[model samples]
Target: MNTSDDDLLDRAFLALADPARRRIIARLSRGPATVNELAEPFAISKQAVSKHIQVLEQAQLVTRSRDAQRRPVHLDPARLEALTAWIDRYRLVREEQFRNLDAVLSEQAASRGRQTKDPS
Candidate 1:
């Protein structure tokens, strides 16, 4: 894995640590949203939402663009893929181990069934 990717991943996980930011990401997952649009569902102020967006932007999880006076935010799914990739590595390992265990159990069960069978 790339060293800088690790650093970026750390930044992303840290940013995701905040409930507000995670909510923001969740909102963005549905579609892109303007700052005011993002703030509407929450009790927080637009400025507060902007701060959360800034944190996400720093983590490279969100991107922004001008839509008139609005700074619309969109999810950067590449970072999401990176995060998923990080998690998937361990998930795959665990899955592989489980599959191996399943095979061993299957073999043991088959062996026992064979021994107990009536021979003609």
Candidate 2:
């Protein structure tokens, strides 16, 4: 990946590292919510929830849109999809490696069995 992509992933992972921010993202996943609504489930102050939202905004994980007097935070599905795709790439590679290893081990076992049967 290029430097910009690396930076984005860095920011996004850092933003998601916080439990409160993760919770905020989870809530936003269902739909958009105003800051007050996002703050409702948390014991933290609304300001704290706002700060968490700011982190998510910086990471490009969420966007806020003006809705009359309110700015509702919306989860950025594209960014989340990018993250998932990145993870899946590595996971697919690892799984393929494991499958190759299993095939090699099976071949070795079959070779040993043939050798024993040949009595040589």
Candidate 3:
């Protein structure tokens, strides 16, 4: 990945490191919500929730939209997709490695069975 992609992943992961921020993301994933709504489920102050939202905004994981008199925070699916894609890349590689190992072990077992049957 390029430097910019690395930086974006760094910020996104850092922002998601906080439980509060992650909760906020989870909430927004359902739909857009104002800061007050987002703060309702947490014990933290509204200001604290707003701060978490700010961090998410900085990370480009969320964005705010003007709707009438309310500014609701919305989750950015594109950024989340990017993160998922990055993770899946590594996951796919590991899965392939495991499959290869399984095949090798199965072949070895079959070879051992044939050797035993041959009584050699």
Candidate 4:
């Protein structure tokens, strides 16, 4: 990955490191919500929730849009998708490696079986 991609992943992961910020993201995943709405379920103040929202905003994980008197925070699926894609790439690589290992083991077992049967 490029430096910019590394920086973005760093920011995104750091922002999600906090439980409150993670909860905020989870809530936004269900739908958009205002700062007040997000704070309602937390023990923290609305201001604290706003701070969490700011972190998410900086990470490009969430966005805010003006809706009349309210500025609602919405989850940015594109960024989430990017993260997922990065993870899936590594996961797929590991899976392929395991499949190759399994094939090798199976071949080795078959070779041993044939050798024993031939009694050479």
Candidate 5:
């Protein structure tokens, strides 16, 4: 809810809006990979892959660090957890609303049954 949070979410969603970026995130989910390795599976050039990685980086969804001789891109679970928590909050509210409606319907049905079984 704050502006910063909204901005972060906007960047995260926008970064993931592209198919290539989504695929890159999927690949990173498995494990960390260097730019070259990340680019190998796609038809786009390594530079394009790097650009996608930059977007992901800005979104805080991914981080890159030097490992030995290569820099590997790694998924940031904290950012993902933040996103998941935000989504789950709304999902839980919706689920509770549905449950409340179901209970109301059940009570109405029970009341109708009682009426039907009465003297008349």
Candidate 6:
């Protein structure tokens, strides 16, 4: 089966959904990490961590560099930028909506107070 572009990015977000996976990405932000290094802090098995790595690899969020037997994973800045752009699109709209709602509420409250006071 062929994977679509959306499917690939969706996979990236899903991979990042787990805290452990996010931590792995965070560690990679500093530098590349071997499977063993990534598994060290987590209670899960190396296989489990490897599974998460596999997901990240599929998303292109993490790229494995061939260095002998060690296929250390590195964070892909492009993938992160894609995710940021996707999030920011909706975030800006919601922020604007909240600002508008705040203004509306303030206007309503002020009008209500004016009505409560002596009105000619």
Candidate 3: segments with Cα more than 4 A from true spot: 1-3, 67-69, 103-120
CA lDDT, every model vs. true structure? 0.87, 0.90, 0.89, 0.88, 0.90, 0.90
- Using alpha carbons, what is the TM-score of model 4? 0.77
Error of 2 at 69 (Å): 3.5
Higher-lDDT candidate among 1 and 4?
4
Q: What is the lDDT of residue 29 in candidate 5?
A: 92
lDDT of 3 by residue, 4-103 (tens): 8788999899998999998888888899999999999899999999899988887799999998988899999899888899999999999999999999
TM for every model, in the order presented, reads 0.72, 0.80, 0.75, 0.77, 0.77, 0.76
- Could you say which candidate leads in TM-score? 2
User: Each candidate: RMSD to true structure?
Assistant: 6.8, 4.9, 5.3, 5.2, 5.5, 4.7
Candidate 5 lDDT: 0.90
Q: What is the lDDT of candidate 1?
A: 0.87
User: Residues 1-120, candidate 4, lDDT per residue (tens digit)?
Assistant: 243888888888889899999888888889999999999999999888888898888889998999899999999989888888999999999999999999999888877756545566
- Candidate 5 wrongly placed segments (more than 4 Å): 1-3, 67-69, 103-120
Ranking of all predicted structures according to TM-score, beginning with the best and ending with the worst: 2, 4, 5, 6, 3, 1
Model 1: residues >4 Å from true position, as ranges? 1-3, 99-120
Please write out the lDDT profile of model 2 over residues 1-120, one tens digit for every residue: 233988999989999899999998889889999999999988989999888998899889999999899999999989989899999999999999999999999888877755545565
The residue-by-residue lDDT of candidate 5 on 1-120, one tens digit each, is 344878999989899799999998898999999999999989999999989998899889999899798999999989988888989999999999999999999988877745555557
Q: Tens digit of lDDT per residue, candidate 1, span 1-120?
A: 343866888889999998889888988999999988889999989889888888798889999898788788999999988888999999999999999999999888877746456744
Model 1, position 87, has a per-residue lDDT of: 95
How many pairs of residues in model 4 come into backbone collision?
Answer: 0
